[model samples]
Target: MISPTLIQAKGLRKGYGQRTVVDGLNLDIREGEVLAIIGPNGAGKSTTLDLLLGLRRPDAGTITYWTTDPSPHVGLQLQSTPFFAGFTAIENLRMFAAFYGKRLKDAQLMEHLHRCGLEEFAKTDALRLSGGQQKRLAIAMTLVHSPKLLFLDEPTAALDPRARRDIRELIRSLADKGTSIVFTSHDMEEVHKLASRLVLIRDGRIIASGSPEELLSQYGTASLEQLYIQLTDEPA
Candidate 1:
Protein backbone atom coordinates (compact mmCIF):
# COMPACT_ATOMS: atom_id res chain seq x y z
CA MET A 1 0.00 0.00 0.00
CA ILE A 2 1.15 3.53 -0.81
CA SER A 3 1.33 6.17 1.91
CA PRO A 4 -0.20 9.57 1.25
CA THR A 5 1.84 12.62 0.30
CA LEU A 6 2.25 15.23 2.98
CA ILE A 7 3.13 18.06 0.61
CA GLN A 8 3.11 18.39 -3.16
CA ALA A 9 4.32 21.31 -5.24
CA LYS A 10 3.44 21.18 -8.93
CA GLY A 11 4.97 23.46 -11.54
CA LEU A 12 5.97 25.88 -8.82
CA ARG A 13 6.95 29.29 -10.19
CA LYS A 14 7.95 32.36 -8.23
CA GLY A 15 9.79 35.59 -8.99
CA TYR A 16 10.39 39.17 -7.99
CA GLY A 17 9.21 41.04 -11.07
CA GLN A 18 11.58 40.20 -13.97
CA ARG A 19 14.02 38.03 -12.03
CA THR A 20 12.48 34.62 -11.59
CA VAL A 21 13.68 32.62 -8.58
CA VAL A 22 12.03 29.23 -8.95
CA ASP A 23 11.14 28.04 -12.44
CA GLY A 24 8.69 25.23 -13.12
CA LEU A 25 9.71 23.20 -10.13
CA ASN A 26 7.82 20.17 -8.85
CA LEU A 27 8.48 18.16 -5.71
CA ASP A 28 6.84 15.98 -3.10
CA ILE A 29 7.61 15.29 0.54
CA ARG A 30 5.98 12.26 2.08
CA GLU A 31 5.16 11.30 5.65
CA GLY A 32 7.85 9.99 7.99
CA GLU A 33 10.91 11.22 6.10
CA VAL A 34 13.37 14.08 5.96
CA LEU A 35 13.83 15.78 2.58
CA ALA A 36 16.69 18.26 2.52
CA ILE A 37 16.90 20.89 -0.22
CA ILE A 38 20.55 21.75 -0.83
CA GLY A 39 21.94 24.13 -3.42
CA PRO A 40 24.16 27.14 -4.01
CA ASN A 41 23.31 30.53 -2.60
CA GLY A 42 20.48 32.37 -4.42
CA ALA A 43 19.34 28.96 -5.67
CA GLY A 44 15.84 29.66 -4.30
CA LYS A 45 15.77 27.41 -1.22
CA SER A 46 14.17 30.02 1.01
CA THR A 47 11.72 31.11 -1.68
CA THR A 48 10.62 27.52 -2.12
CA LEU A 49 10.01 27.15 1.61
CA ASP A 50 8.01 30.37 1.63
CA LEU A 51 5.74 29.12 -1.11
CA LEU A 52 5.36 25.72 0.52
CA LEU A 53 4.31 27.28 3.81
CA GLY A 54 1.56 29.29 2.09
CA LEU A 55 3.36 32.44 3.24
CA ARG A 56 3.30 33.44 -0.43
CA ARG A 57 1.42 32.25 -3.48
CA PRO A 58 3.31 30.69 -6.37
CA ASP A 59 2.92 32.57 -9.60
CA ALA A 60 1.89 29.39 -11.43
CA GLY A 61 1.58 26.26 -9.34
CA THR A 62 -0.27 24.45 -6.64
CA ILE A 63 1.27 23.89 -3.22
CA THR A 64 -0.91 21.74 -1.03
CA TYR A 65 -0.67 20.01 2.32
CA TRP A 66 -2.60 16.80 1.55
CA THR A 67 -4.70 16.04 4.62
CA THR A 68 -8.41 15.60 5.11
CA ASP A 69 -8.35 17.67 8.28
CA PRO A 70 -9.61 21.19 7.60
CA SER A 71 -6.62 22.85 9.32
CA PRO A 72 -3.88 20.62 7.94
CA HIS A 73 -0.91 21.06 10.27
CA VAL A 74 2.51 22.58 9.62
CA GLY A 75 5.24 24.35 11.59
CA LEU A 76 7.90 26.68 10.24
CA GLN A 77 11.25 28.04 11.35
CA LEU A 78 12.13 30.87 9.02
CA GLN A 79 15.74 31.97 8.35
CA SER A 80 15.88 33.79 11.66
CA THR A 81 14.80 32.83 15.18
CA PRO A 82 11.95 35.15 16.06
CA PHE A 83 11.01 35.93 19.65
CA PHE A 84 9.97 38.88 21.73
CA ALA A 85 13.10 40.38 23.23
CA GLY A 86 11.58 41.28 26.56
CA PHE A 87 10.00 37.90 27.06
CA THR A 88 11.69 35.11 28.93
CA ALA A 89 12.42 31.81 27.23
CA ILE A 90 9.26 30.16 28.52
CA GLU A 91 7.33 33.35 27.87
CA ASN A 92 8.35 33.36 24.24
CA LEU A 93 7.13 29.81 23.85
CA ARG A 94 3.88 30.70 25.55
CA MET A 95 3.12 33.44 23.01
CA PHE A 96 3.80 31.35 19.91
CA ALA A 97 2.10 28.26 21.37
CA ALA A 98 -0.98 30.32 22.05
CA PHE A 99 -0.95 31.54 18.47
CA TYR A 100 -1.13 27.90 17.42
CA GLY A 101 -4.44 27.82 19.28
CA LYS A 102 -3.16 25.10 21.54
CA ARG A 103 -3.03 25.16 25.28
CA LEU A 104 0.31 24.04 26.67
CA LYS A 105 0.42 24.50 30.41
CA ASP A 106 3.50 25.25 32.46
CA ALA A 107 4.27 21.59 33.07
CA GLN A 108 4.32 20.81 29.35
CA LEU A 109 6.30 23.95 28.61
CA MET A 110 8.86 22.88 31.21
CA GLU A 111 8.99 19.47 29.62
CA HIS A 112 10.02 20.99 26.31
CA LEU A 113 12.51 23.18 28.12
CA HIS A 114 14.06 20.10 29.71
CA ARG A 115 14.18 18.33 26.37
CA CYS A 116 15.88 21.35 24.79
CA GLY A 117 18.35 21.53 27.71
CA LEU A 118 17.09 24.96 28.52
CA GLU A 119 15.37 24.30 31.82
CA GLU A 120 18.05 26.10 33.78
CA PHE A 121 17.79 29.07 31.48
CA ALA A 122 14.00 29.12 31.21
CA LYS A 123 13.74 32.32 33.15
CA THR A 124 16.34 34.15 31.10
CA ASP A 125 15.10 36.82 28.75
CA ALA A 126 14.95 35.61 25.15
CA LEU A 127 17.00 38.57 23.92
CA ARG A 128 19.74 37.67 26.36
CA LEU A 129 20.14 34.12 25.07
CA SER A 130 23.25 33.34 23.05
CA GLY A 131 22.97 32.53 19.37
CA GLY A 132 23.04 28.78 19.95
CA GLN A 133 20.55 29.09 22.76
CA GLN A 134 18.34 31.16 20.50
CA LYS A 135 18.43 28.52 17.80
CA ARG A 136 17.54 25.85 20.33
CA LEU A 137 14.69 28.00 21.50
CA ALA A 138 13.45 28.26 17.92
CA ILE A 139 13.44 24.48 17.51
CA ALA A 140 11.62 24.02 20.82
CA MET A 141 9.04 26.62 19.84
CA THR A 142 8.47 24.96 16.45
CA LEU A 143 7.74 21.70 18.24
CA VAL A 144 5.15 23.36 20.45
CA HIS A 145 2.24 22.38 18.24
CA SER A 146 3.49 18.91 17.35
CA PRO A 147 2.92 19.67 13.68
CA LYS A 148 2.59 17.06 10.96
CA LEU A 149 4.91 18.83 8.54
CA LEU A 150 7.93 20.90 9.61
CA PHE A 151 9.77 23.44 7.46
CA LEU A 152 13.22 24.35 8.73
CA ASP A 153 15.38 26.90 6.89
CA GLU A 154 19.15 26.74 7.40
CA PRO A 155 18.61 25.57 10.98
CA THR A 156 22.27 25.33 11.84
CA ALA A 157 23.75 28.04 9.67
CA ALA A 158 25.45 29.76 12.60
CA LEU A 159 26.29 27.42 15.45
CA ASP A 160 29.19 25.69 17.08
CA PRO A 161 29.83 21.99 16.51
CA ARG A 162 28.09 20.86 19.69
CA ALA A 163 24.97 22.93 19.09
CA ARG A 164 24.74 21.85 15.45
CA ARG A 165 24.89 18.22 16.47
CA ASP A 166 22.25 18.76 19.12
CA ILE A 167 19.80 20.35 16.68
CA ARG A 168 20.41 17.64 14.08
CA GLU A 169 19.76 14.97 16.70
CA LEU A 170 16.53 16.69 17.63
CA ILE A 171 15.45 16.62 14.00
CA ARG A 172 16.30 12.95 13.70
CA SER A 173 14.18 12.16 16.75
CA LEU A 174 11.23 14.04 15.29
CA ALA A 175 11.44 12.23 11.95
CA ASP A 176 11.55 8.92 13.81
CA LYS A 177 8.29 9.96 15.44
CA GLY A 178 6.66 10.27 11.97
CA THR A 179 6.79 14.02 11.36
CA SER A 180 7.66 14.83 7.76
CA ILE A 181 10.46 17.36 7.42
CA VAL A 182 11.53 19.72 4.63
CA PHE A 183 14.73 21.46 5.59
CA THR A 184 17.32 23.58 3.74
CA SER A 185 20.90 23.59 4.86
CA HIS A 186 24.26 24.82 3.62
CA ASP A 187 26.03 22.42 5.94
CA MET A 188 26.58 19.30 3.85
CA GLU A 189 27.68 17.31 6.89
CA GLU A 190 24.39 18.01 8.64
CA VAL A 191 22.46 17.34 5.44
CA HIS A 192 24.16 13.98 4.96
CA LYS A 193 23.52 13.04 8.57
CA LEU A 194 19.88 14.14 8.77
CA ALA A 195 18.23 13.71 5.39
CA SER A 196 16.54 10.47 4.32
CA ARG A 197 16.64 11.91 0.80
CA LEU A 198 18.29 14.86 -0.88
CA VAL A 199 16.65 17.23 -3.37
CA LEU A 200 19.24 19.34 -5.15
CA ILE A 201 18.26 22.53 -6.93
CA ARG A 202 20.10 24.82 -9.32
CA ASP A 203 18.80 28.07 -10.79
CA GLY A 204 15.41 27.22 -9.21
CA ARG A 205 14.93 23.77 -10.76
CA ILE A 206 15.72 20.34 -9.31
CA ILE A 207 18.91 19.21 -11.00
CA ALA A 208 19.60 16.04 -9.08
CA SER A 209 18.12 14.06 -6.21
CA GLY A 210 18.78 10.78 -4.43
CA SER A 211 20.21 9.36 -1.26
CA PRO A 212 23.56 10.84 -0.22
CA GLU A 213 25.44 7.69 -1.11
CA GLU A 214 23.56 7.27 -4.38
CA LEU A 215 24.27 10.80 -5.52
CA LEU A 216 27.89 10.59 -4.45
CA SER A 217 28.40 7.34 -6.36
CA GLN A 218 26.47 8.61 -9.39
CA TYR A 219 28.50 11.84 -9.56
CA GLY A 220 31.77 10.07 -8.64
CA THR A 221 32.20 12.23 -5.58
CA ALA A 222 33.21 11.47 -1.99
CA SER A 223 30.81 13.87 -0.35
CA LEU A 224 27.46 15.62 -0.81
CA GLU A 225 29.34 18.94 -1.02
CA GLN A 226 31.26 17.80 -4.07
CA LEU A 227 28.13 16.39 -5.69
CA TYR A 228 26.32 19.67 -5.10
CA ILE A 229 29.10 21.69 -6.71
CA GLN A 230 29.19 19.38 -9.72
CA LEU A 231 25.44 19.40 -10.21
CA THR A 232 24.94 23.15 -9.85
CA ASP A 233 27.92 23.83 -12.12
CA GLU A 234 26.24 22.00 -14.96
CA PRO A 235 23.71 23.97 -17.00
CA ALA A 236 20.21 22.53 -17.23
Candidate 2:
Protein backbone atom coordinates (compact mmCIF):
# COMPACT_ATOMS: atom_id res chain seq x y z
CA MET A 1 0.00 0.00 0.00
CA ILE A 2 1.09 3.55 -0.74
CA SER A 3 1.54 6.18 1.92
CA PRO A 4 -0.76 9.16 2.01
CA THR A 5 0.46 12.55 0.92
CA LEU A 6 1.11 14.91 3.79
CA ILE A 7 1.73 18.13 1.80
CA GLN A 8 1.01 19.05 -1.76
CA ALA A 9 2.24 22.34 -3.23
CA LYS A 10 1.33 23.65 -6.65
CA GLY A 11 2.81 26.56 -8.62
CA LEU A 12 4.80 27.84 -5.69
CA ARG A 13 6.25 31.21 -6.64
CA LYS A 14 8.07 33.77 -4.55
CA GLY A 15 10.04 36.84 -5.54
CA TYR A 16 11.55 40.07 -4.41
CA GLY A 17 11.13 43.40 -6.21
CA GLN A 18 13.02 42.47 -9.38
CA ARG A 19 14.22 38.92 -8.89
CA THR A 20 12.28 35.69 -8.66
CA VAL A 21 13.32 33.22 -6.02
CA VAL A 22 11.02 30.22 -6.40
CA ASP A 23 9.17 29.82 -9.67
CA GLY A 24 6.20 27.65 -10.41
CA LEU A 25 7.38 24.75 -8.27
CA ASN A 26 5.18 21.78 -7.47
CA LEU A 27 6.03 18.95 -5.16
CA ASP A 28 4.51 16.39 -2.84
CA ILE A 29 5.73 15.39 0.57
CA ARG A 30 4.56 11.99 1.66
CA GLU A 31 4.39 10.39 5.07
CA GLY A 32 7.50 8.87 6.68
CA GLU A 33 9.94 9.73 3.90
CA VAL A 34 13.04 11.87 3.59
CA LEU A 35 13.04 14.36 0.76
CA ALA A 36 16.25 16.30 0.23
CA ILE A 37 16.37 19.47 -1.78
CA ILE A 38 19.89 20.05 -3.10
CA GLY A 39 21.21 23.16 -4.79
CA PRO A 40 23.96 25.69 -4.89
CA ASN A 41 23.71 29.06 -3.21
CA GLY A 42 21.03 31.45 -4.56
CA ALA A 43 19.03 28.57 -5.97
CA GLY A 44 15.89 29.35 -4.00
CA LYS A 45 16.14 26.31 -1.71
CA SER A 46 15.70 28.50 1.36
CA THR A 47 12.77 30.31 -0.21
CA THR A 48 11.13 27.03 -1.06
CA LEU A 49 11.51 25.88 2.52
CA ASP A 50 10.09 29.10 3.91
CA LEU A 51 7.08 28.79 1.67
CA LEU A 52 6.50 25.19 2.58
CA LEU A 53 6.71 25.93 6.29
CA GLY A 54 4.51 29.06 6.03
CA LEU A 55 7.32 31.25 7.26
CA ARG A 56 6.91 33.21 4.05
CA ARG A 57 3.87 33.67 1.91
CA PRO A 58 4.12 32.81 -1.75
CA ASP A 59 3.06 35.31 -4.30
CA ALA A 60 1.37 32.56 -6.29
CA GLY A 61 0.64 28.98 -5.29
CA THR A 62 -1.50 26.75 -3.22
CA ILE A 63 -0.40 24.41 -0.46
CA THR A 64 -2.74 21.75 0.80
CA TYR A 65 -2.27 19.54 3.83
CA TRP A 66 -4.20 16.34 3.57
CA THR A 67 -3.81 15.56 7.24
CA THR A 68 -5.77 17.23 9.98
CA ASP A 69 -3.99 19.55 12.41
CA PRO A 70 -1.18 20.20 9.97
CA SER A 71 -0.04 23.34 11.75
CA PRO A 72 1.11 21.58 14.89
CA HIS A 73 2.28 18.56 12.96
CA VAL A 74 5.18 20.47 11.38
CA GLY A 75 8.52 21.63 12.80
CA LEU A 76 11.43 23.66 11.44
CA GLN A 77 15.16 23.81 12.18
CA LEU A 78 17.06 26.45 10.28
CA GLN A 79 20.78 26.79 9.58
CA SER A 80 21.25 29.19 12.43
CA THR A 81 18.73 28.30 15.11
CA PRO A 82 17.79 31.30 17.21
CA PHE A 83 17.88 30.93 20.96
CA PHE A 84 18.26 33.07 24.01
CA ALA A 85 21.99 33.49 24.51
CA GLY A 86 21.67 33.56 28.28
CA PHE A 87 19.29 30.61 28.55
CA THR A 88 20.53 27.13 29.33
CA ALA A 89 19.81 24.42 26.78
CA ILE A 90 17.17 22.85 28.97
CA GLU A 91 15.63 26.21 29.69
CA ASN A 92 15.45 26.96 25.98
CA LEU A 93 13.61 23.73 25.41
CA ARG A 94 11.20 24.56 28.18
CA MET A 95 10.46 27.96 26.71
CA PHE A 96 9.84 26.52 23.26
CA ALA A 97 7.67 23.78 24.68
CA ALA A 98 5.53 26.35 26.39
CA PHE A 99 5.38 28.36 23.18
CA TYR A 100 4.00 25.28 21.47
CA GLY A 101 1.36 25.09 24.21
CA LYS A 102 2.86 21.92 25.69
CA ARG A 103 4.31 21.39 29.10
CA LEU A 104 7.10 18.85 29.25
CA LYS A 105 8.31 17.49 32.54
CA ASP A 106 11.99 17.48 33.37
CA ALA A 107 12.29 13.77 32.64
CA GLN A 108 10.62 14.10 29.26
CA LEU A 109 12.69 17.13 28.35
CA MET A 110 15.88 15.39 29.43
CA GLU A 111 15.02 12.46 27.17
CA HIS A 112 14.90 14.80 24.19
CA LEU A 113 18.16 16.48 25.16
CA HIS A 114 19.73 13.04 25.49
CA ARG A 115 18.51 12.03 22.05
CA CYS A 116 20.24 15.07 20.53
CA GLY A 117 23.41 14.25 22.50
CA LEU A 118 23.00 17.43 24.48
CA GLU A 119 22.40 15.79 27.84
CA GLU A 120 25.73 16.94 29.23
CA PHE A 121 25.11 20.41 27.92
CA ALA A 122 21.69 20.69 29.52
CA LYS A 123 22.91 23.26 32.01
CA THR A 124 25.22 25.01 29.59
CA ASP A 125 24.18 28.38 28.28
CA ALA A 126 23.11 28.37 24.64
CA LEU A 127 25.78 30.94 23.76
CA ARG A 128 28.60 28.85 25.22
CA LEU A 129 27.78 25.58 23.49
CA SER A 130 29.97 24.48 20.62
CA GLY A 131 28.68 24.70 17.09
CA GLY A 132 27.60 21.07 16.99
CA GLN A 133 26.06 21.26 20.43
CA GLN A 134 24.14 24.37 19.41
CA LYS A 135 22.86 22.54 16.34
CA ARG A 136 21.78 19.63 18.45
CA LEU A 137 20.03 21.93 20.86
CA ALA A 138 18.19 23.51 17.98
CA ILE A 139 17.09 20.09 16.84
CA ALA A 140 15.98 19.25 20.37
CA MET A 141 13.94 22.43 20.46
CA THR A 142 12.11 21.38 17.29
CA LEU A 143 10.98 18.12 18.93
CA VAL A 144 9.38 19.73 21.97
CA HIS A 145 6.01 19.22 20.34
CA SER A 146 6.71 15.84 18.72
CA PRO A 147 6.06 17.05 15.22
CA LYS A 148 5.32 14.50 12.50
CA LEU A 149 7.03 16.41 9.69
CA LEU A 150 10.36 18.23 10.04
CA PHE A 151 12.03 20.82 7.83
CA LEU A 152 15.78 21.11 8.29
CA ASP A 153 18.11 23.55 6.52
CA GLU A 154 21.81 22.73 6.34
CA PRO A 155 21.41 20.49 9.36
CA THR A 156 24.99 19.27 9.42
CA ALA A 157 26.69 22.32 8.01
CA ALA A 158 29.95 23.52 9.59
CA LEU A 159 30.21 20.50 11.88
CA ASP A 160 33.18 18.24 12.41
CA PRO A 161 33.10 14.72 11.00
CA ARG A 162 32.02 13.02 14.22
CA ALA A 163 29.39 15.62 14.91
CA ARG A 164 28.12 15.31 11.35
CA ARG A 165 27.78 11.55 11.78
CA ASP A 166 25.90 12.05 15.03
CA ILE A 167 23.45 14.44 13.45
CA ARG A 168 22.98 12.07 10.51
CA GLU A 169 22.26 9.22 12.90
CA LEU A 170 19.77 11.35 14.80
CA ILE A 171 17.96 12.14 11.57
CA ARG A 172 17.91 8.47 10.60
CA SER A 173 16.53 7.52 13.98
CA LEU A 174 13.73 10.05 13.57
CA ALA A 175 12.90 8.65 10.13
CA ASP A 176 12.96 5.14 11.52
CA LYS A 177 10.34 6.11 14.06
CA GLY A 178 8.13 7.45 11.23
CA THR A 179 8.92 11.17 11.05
CA SER A 180 8.80 12.65 7.57
CA ILE A 181 11.68 15.00 6.77
CA VAL A 182 12.36 17.62 4.14
CA PHE A 183 15.81 19.17 4.25
CA THR A 184 18.03 21.42 2.16
CA SER A 185 21.76 20.79 2.18
CA HIS A 186 24.83 21.65 0.18
CA ASP A 187 26.51 18.47 1.40
CA MET A 188 26.08 16.04 -1.45
CA GLU A 189 27.45 13.08 0.48
CA GLU A 190 25.15 13.78 3.41
CA VAL A 191 22.21 14.07 1.09
CA HIS A 192 23.10 10.81 -0.61
CA LYS A 193 23.32 9.09 2.74
CA LEU A 194 20.04 10.30 4.24
CA ALA A 195 17.70 11.18 1.41
CA SER A 196 15.42 8.60 -0.20
CA ARG A 197 14.29 11.14 -2.74
CA LEU A 198 16.26 14.06 -4.18
CA VAL A 199 15.15 17.25 -5.87
CA LEU A 200 17.60 19.52 -7.65
CA ILE A 201 16.64 23.17 -7.98
CA ARG A 202 18.41 25.86 -9.94
CA ASP A 203 17.62 29.56 -10.38
CA GLY A 204 14.23 29.05 -8.72
CA ARG A 205 13.27 26.02 -10.76
CA ILE A 206 13.47 22.28 -10.22
CA ILE A 207 15.79 20.86 -12.88
CA ALA A 208 16.21 17.25 -11.83
CA SER A 209 14.84 14.90 -9.23
CA GLY A 210 15.11 11.21 -8.33
CA SER A 211 16.57 8.80 -5.88
CA PRO A 212 20.35 8.96 -5.47
CA GLU A 213 20.91 5.73 -7.35
CA GLU A 214 18.40 6.67 -9.99
CA LEU A 215 19.99 10.06 -10.53
CA LEU A 216 23.50 8.65 -10.70
CA SER A 217 22.36 6.04 -13.19
CA GLN A 218 20.50 8.56 -15.31
CA TYR A 219 23.30 11.13 -15.39
CA GLY A 220 25.98 8.43 -15.81
CA THR A 221 27.82 9.97 -12.90
CA ALA A 222 29.54 8.12 -10.08
CA SER A 223 28.47 10.53 -7.33
CA LEU A 224 25.94 13.20 -6.49
CA GLU A 225 28.66 15.86 -6.42
CA GLN A 226 29.60 15.21 -10.00
CA LEU A 227 25.99 15.17 -11.09
CA TYR A 228 25.32 18.40 -9.25
CA ILE A 229 28.21 20.13 -10.95
CA GLN A 230 27.10 18.84 -14.29
CA LEU A 231 23.58 20.08 -13.73
CA THR A 232 24.24 23.48 -12.15
CA ASP A 233 27.71 24.56 -13.18
CA GLU A 234 27.53 27.06 -15.95
CA PRO A 235 29.97 26.87 -18.84
CA ALA A 236 32.52 29.66 -19.05
- Candidate 1 on 95-155: residue-level lDDT in tens? 9898889789999999988777788889999989988788888888888999888889888
Model 1 accuracy (lDDT, Cα): 0.86
Q: Which ranges in model 1 have alpha carbons more than 4 Å from their true place?
A: 68-72
**What TM-score, over all chains together, does every model reach?**
0.94, 0.95
Candidate 2 segments whose C-alpha is farther than 4 A from its true place: 234-236
Q: What lDDT does candidate 1 reach at residue 106?
A: 94
lDDT of 2 by residue, 155-212 (tens): 8888888878988999999999999999988989999999999999998889998899
- On a 0 to 100 scale, what is the lDDT of residue 58 in model 2? 99
Model 1, poorest ten-residue lDDT window? 63-72
Q: lDDT per model, in order?
A: 0.86, 0.91
In candidate 2 the C-alpha lDDT for residue 158 amounts to 81
